[model samples]
Target: MTQHDTDHALKTGGEQGYLRIATEEAFATREQIDVYLRMVRDGTADRGMTSLWGFYAQSPSERAMQIIERLLDLGERRIADMDATGIDKAILALTSPGVQPFSDTHEAQRIARSANDLLAERCAAHPDRFIGMTAVAPQDPQWSAEEIRRGAHDLGFKGVQINSHTQGRYLDEPFFDPIFRALSDTGQPLYIHPGTPPDAMIGPLLDAGLDGAIYGFGVETGMHLLRLITIGIFDRYPDLQIMVGHMGEALPYWLYRLDYMHQAGIRSARYERMKPLKKTIADYFRSNVLVTCSGMAWEPAIRFAQQVMGEDRVMYAMDYPYQYEAHEVRALDAMELTPEVKRQFFQTNAERWFKL
Candidate 1:
């Protein structure tokens, strides 16, 4: 990594860790479309889930295009701003909602491939300064594996960031088994970010949307991670590396409760293969899971993660575009830890996690 902007003086250029100006959830133009427009299935269907509609608003075609163009420029400007803020690299993905917006299995795969290709090109042009994570449609098991391989081999990406669930199907669904196998085989780090309409978004809660993401993204994602842990996905695929944004989807805070529940025997048979769900979760976090300081980079949270997962597993990141660089940079710049820990969060951990 190169030295950051000299004007903002601090001890930079150290090799302890790396920084990622992340915009993981902002790439998919379609992910923002309301579910009313892309109605994939009836509510009773297997993957029966309603999509969030209020992600963005209506606009004329030409005006929408112009707005998009401006957003792209703003994204680039954010990168420059990140550079000035002392971020060494920007680990960009095709935003969130991602390919799940496409209901047709074939179409989803196609759009995902295209998005990965475009992101790959971006990384190619600025290999030193930018890195990419592949996008894949997890609607089907077979196609998901293929897309992940293509992203890694063809696009030169380090890992992937994905929504908590597709439609209504959670991560532990059988639909993702083949995909999980390939990920374990290739050792691709799968990032699981959160995006689910709140309880109010469906049925009576239709208007209760946007409410979820404000504080609900973390809760929803935490629920998903809890399910995965209880279901023992990590036990089945011990090598699978999963990355959760928003500080491990509130895992650290909820871990003790999970442990107590297990001790209280709430879900006895659920965690059959693991030593303990809490231990398994923490071990996975320490061994296979990576966490990003996307929107929740509190000093206590970051420090807690450092002690639990060690400084090597936490990476400094701005949720960028959707989350400005300042939020992330300021978090790192203001972190009250040893210089070594600060360096690790800012640079070294991400360097190893993303291979940047």
Candidate 2:
């Protein structure tokens, strides 16, 4: 935006302040260590965006480390641009493809420790503004549980982060049992972000160099979420607070198609016994899932999602470092909702969701 528009944001939005769904992976270096190590083990010259270093490099990682780091340091500048886009807080977490790249549970657990420790230390510098989302290796459920508790109770983390999918294992898979139970016991919602998709599907997508934002990221992440819903993960873990972004990843709108055709196809038997997959999905979306306005701010999408999910479940986020911070702030400010709804979307709802 323009200088005047930025000033307006500071005055109007800044006065109230918003919380950022920020990440360490956002600012991390490209995949020097992680990917180099992986290449060593695999004995091949695979140049994918597998590490934080890769994120900064353009090796087809959909990486945005440079932007994320620049944006993270732009807190004051961002506020100045927003007409008082009062960014009171930023909820931080490790970047994606975090521990998922490690093949062994033991190695993944170690990576989780290192990543979580580093994140906690960084956030310690800005306790008020930065809340931590603990990283967990879904492969080692017990260790993941221990570290999550440690992050929450010991480091004062807000919640835990699980890549949308782990090692081709969905969140609804049996491996997440301990992780789920521990999170439930501690009352911390799991913050699910997208990681690389399944290996079987990655080759074709990579051949076309369209593996991330252009198409795959949202679709892969959305599939994980769908599996979680369809498999009744929330039904099993009632208190689980699962989050999915990108305007609920096209689920809420497409829900009607399934709801109307519940009596037919592969989902029919389950629907007859389970009372319809569509209703279950809606209930899970409404009751368990929380959506953030991350990188998907089409006005109609935002308005309809808020109406469908309610302002309470919606949180404002810049997807900073990966997205244009100025644009995100402007998008929220420009939403033509009643002032009350704006307040909730801009600040209140996030405060409650992140418990800020």
Candidate 3:
């Protein structure tokens, strides 16, 4: 079927009887973009940030330009795009490398608060079509904790989005306990979105032109999640809910190996930090973590993730603007899933996880 016809069919509640609630949609405020541009100009940006945002800032390519334009729009244009792509509603968040790149704690906190306020405003303006996720500066854990509460209590945001690794520091560190405590206390899921690798890890990836979305994002984000698991983040914050996009950043496929290798490392006492956990690597995934098939519409991969992670733990995400392709929506709609399962994949799971 044609793209327009497919969209129309979905909108009209066609054979695909499910609402598409895209959970990982992204938007960026103009102020954030301006800060990114200034960082690029001043040569003070993180290497990965420079590689990703700098390219988009300067590159005149149609894809880069289109993404930039779409990222800046949170109004009718964004809603129209969603309608045209068969998405019923979107859980919106700040684009990656958000506020996490700023070394100045106050500056980062200010910008993050501004971004959260803008997102809350956009969501309120389009309550039926948009849902807001809190963005906070992890540079100051206490401030981040307070922002999380403010976003949940005052702004009505449903969850928190942290771009992976703040200034080379991962959430696995004890310093981030306040943020985790807040998330658990507030019952808001924490979506760990991908950012470009830090300086320590971006050199090789950038040299190979894979420092952005293609390879580095998954590597960095997957490592972040694994670090949380191995370091027993979930044991400390048992009530915390963590969401990872791109089919759990390919972590599901490596579950067996991860579990085995992790056990081996602990048995050998090869690393002082590798301690025993109450559960296995995969157990944490099944329990505390949720996965989204954002930018990953392939049938086999999605099905494999569902099979391994449990059907209820997997949900749909368009990865909007970055991997925006209406055909992907059509493809997901065509997956060979039973009616109930399809509904869970495209709609109910998101509603449940994000508390929509």
Q: Which model scores highest in lDDT?
A: 3
Sort every candidate by TM-score, greatest first. 3, 2, 1
Which residue ranges in model 1 land beyond 4 Å of their true spot?
1-25, 29-78, 198-210, 266-279, 325-328
Number of the top candidate by TM-score?
3
**What digit string (tens of lDDT, one per residue) describes model 3 on residues 143-240?**
99999999999999999999999989999999999999999889999999999999999999999999878989999999999999999998988878
lDDT of each: 0.64, 0.65, 0.90
What value of lDDT does candidate 2 attain over all alpha carbons? Answer: 0.65
Q: Give the distance in Å from residue 229's predicted Cα in candidate 2 to where it truly belongs.
A: 1.1
**Which regions in candidate 3 have their CA more than 4 angstroms from the true location?**
1-15
Predicted structure 1: lDDT: 0.64
Q: How do the residues 1-356 of candidate 2 rate in per-residue lDDT, one tens digit apiece?
A: 35554345433424444343332223232332455345445643223344223444434433444454454442444334333334556676666667665666676677678766766776786666667788887777888888888988988888887767766678777767898889888888887787656665667766776667655677788878877776767777887888877777677787667445543544456443344443446667788898877777567888888777777887776665576556556556666788788778767776776676
- The estimated TM-scores of all candidates read 0.80, 0.82, 0.96
